[model samples]
Target chain A: MTIRKTASDYSRSHEPIVWGLFSAGGVIVAFFIPALILLTSLLVQVGIADEAVLSFDRVQSFAQAWWGKLFILAVIALSLYHTVHRIHHGLHDVHIHIPDSLAIIIFYGGATVLSCLVFVWLLAIGW
Target chain B: MSTSEKTIYRKPYVQNQSASWWLKNKFYIWYMVREGTAIFVFLYALILMLGLLRLAQGEAAWNAWVASLSNPAYIVFHGIALIAAMYHVHTFFKMFPKVIVIRFGNWKMPESYLIAGQWVGFVVCTAVILGIGLFVGV
Candidate 1:
């Protein structure tokens, strides 16, 4: 027997909002994160990539550009939500009991605060 | 509402589980490892934020930040993070079809197709970023 959920039932839960961000962020991580790690850290260090790939002036100019700022913000903010959401649920799998409200505040709220900070820093970086 | 007449509700018993329960099963161990990638991702994000903070300070500060990444410890850390991120990509693509379904009329798109398309997208994205990093700068 199918027990259909009403619109009101959906609205009462935060699952949709958080799950949306989680999946979106997961896609971003899968597509972009490995490359980011390679570009920003590993390849250059190993001498397989040029040092100018992440030279101070190059990265600085990138951060100062509008699209570049948006890119940085999206990558950082979404990845934060993606990881924290997993960490929150992963805690439960490990039998650690955190009260729902408190967990939401700590994980989701913390992601939001950090995302805001990224946005602020991007703005501070200027165009 | 006299204190003697008030009834207290009893809670149901829940079986206690040790935090290391995942260690007992190979499948559970892999599951934990997959979830564990989040910690690496989170730490890397913090590192990027720190880089951004330093970038905002000045050229001297930014150069200092770049120099710091060359430290042996940070190189090791990034190596681990790079592996963790690749693992995340693998697990994410494996799980994506279950999360989102697509159908056209009577025929449904195969999960293999979805996974393959995602890989193509991932390769394209990686190439674009590599191009930008390698070619966009002076």
Candidate 2:
């Protein structure tokens, strides 16, 4: 006869993996934000036509371009995950009992949906 | 006790708390935010590389890539990303004063002032780039 492990046992086994993924994802997004800002600023200076700088026209062109949109999406998605994870942990630090699993699902899930929508909108504009 | 044992001996001890106790402390939330943002920066780098690749491929390929990004799903995704990125930046700038610790002679600079300076710098840089773009016209 075999003994079955309870939910606690499963959680104990999986907790580290979940935390690790959350941490890695958080770190990736955190680092991407500043870098993207810098890169975009530089790109605007060097790559785009002079008139496009700071204007919606430039933003439109960049947003519409495949490479540009992807770059923007990656930055947003990763950062969103990172921000949510950090906020979750931050709340936990303050003795808030916000369930870790639920927080992860909501924050990361929300980020995914938002990123997808933005990418679609940019594409639709025919940029 | 031998001569070598003459010196006072202290009892060995082990920490009772978990390894993450320091991070779990409420006061350290800001530090965590800073660290979290650092991770996002790395992800952005990869995105940049992809963009460069698309740029190198020439107009048709690049346009095709751009067209694909128009899907509604992607637009929503980017919108969330933008918010996340803004949060990261705001937090990073807020923490800048603490992390850098700049002292002017005997007096230390205020963190608020440092944060304000950073925001100003960001605005100036953005303005400069925009100005250049307007002058050149793509």
Candidate 3:
């Protein structure tokens, strides 16, 4: 067996994994558009756009009936992961050598924190 | 040369097939497009949050926010965001069939069919939203 000696070989081997990340990211993002539109329409209807109502009371009522919040969460979380993965590879192309484990930790860690913050904020506001 | 005396030919050089730009750089391009969309989405979320905050404040605040959005700079930023969003949507729908697998007993659906269904769903939803917005003035 001949050992592969080039970047092309490395990429060819890893193409499927890269494509999987991209495709999954895409589907998640696609679903988000309609979900977002629905959420916006709800906000408009509830006088959230016309009145001073930041209390959790308003959001809980909204989310109770609208299942779009879950989709929003998924979109944000998946897109965050997708962002980090793509950026990591881009940095690699520029000869940056971040250890794989450290990179994954940082990326996913950031995503988790951000997602948690979103949930907490929404819940705190009663959504 | 006589058939028996013929020398076997061996090519002295093999052309390098790996240096072409697309072959060497397509991955990078894909990375850029994907990451760029992510960043755009992040920015879009921020804008959306701002709008939500303003809405939560009051109608005056919401109107002010909409008015601000009418500024040239905001329009440009929103335009860029819209373009980035469309790119993300188009690319994502193209890949939808592969990521999620739905099996119906003995029948399996193809990816293209799934993507087409998604687009149809999107168009229908958009139409409904637009109809509601126009009819209700919301």
Of the two candidates 1 and 2, the one with more favorable DockQ, higher being better, is 1
lDDT by residue for model 3 (B25-47), tens: 78757746755666666665556
> Which model is ahead, 1 or 2, in terms of TM-score?
1
Taking the tens digit of each residue's C-alpha lDDT, what string does model 1 give over A62-89?
Answer: 9988899989999999999999999999
Worst 10 residues of 2 chain A by lDDT: A43-52
Error of 1 at B103 (Å): 1.8
DockQ of predicted model 2: 0.07
Ranking by lDDT: 1, 3, 2
Residue B45 miss distance in model 3 (angstroms): 2.9
Off by over 4 Å in 1: A1-11, B1-17
Please report the interface RMSD of model 3 to 1 decimal. Answer: 6.5
On lDDT, the candidate that comes out on top is: 1
- For this target, which candidate reaches the highest DockQ against the unseen true structure? 1
In what order do the candidates fall by DockQ, top score first? Answer: 1, 3, 2
lDDT per residue for candidate 2 within A1-127, as digits (tens), equals 8898788776435446445555445434434443345334333334443323444455556666787677566656555555555655665654567675687577666656755655565455465
Q: What are the runs in model 3 whose C-alpha is more than 4 Å off? A: A1-25, A34-72, A93-96, B1-31, B49-68, B97-112, B128-137
* Predictions' DockQ, in order: 0.70, 0.07, 0.21
Task: Give the chain B TM-score achieved by candidate 3.
Answer: 0.71
| lDDT (Cα, 0-100) at A84 in candidate 2 | 58
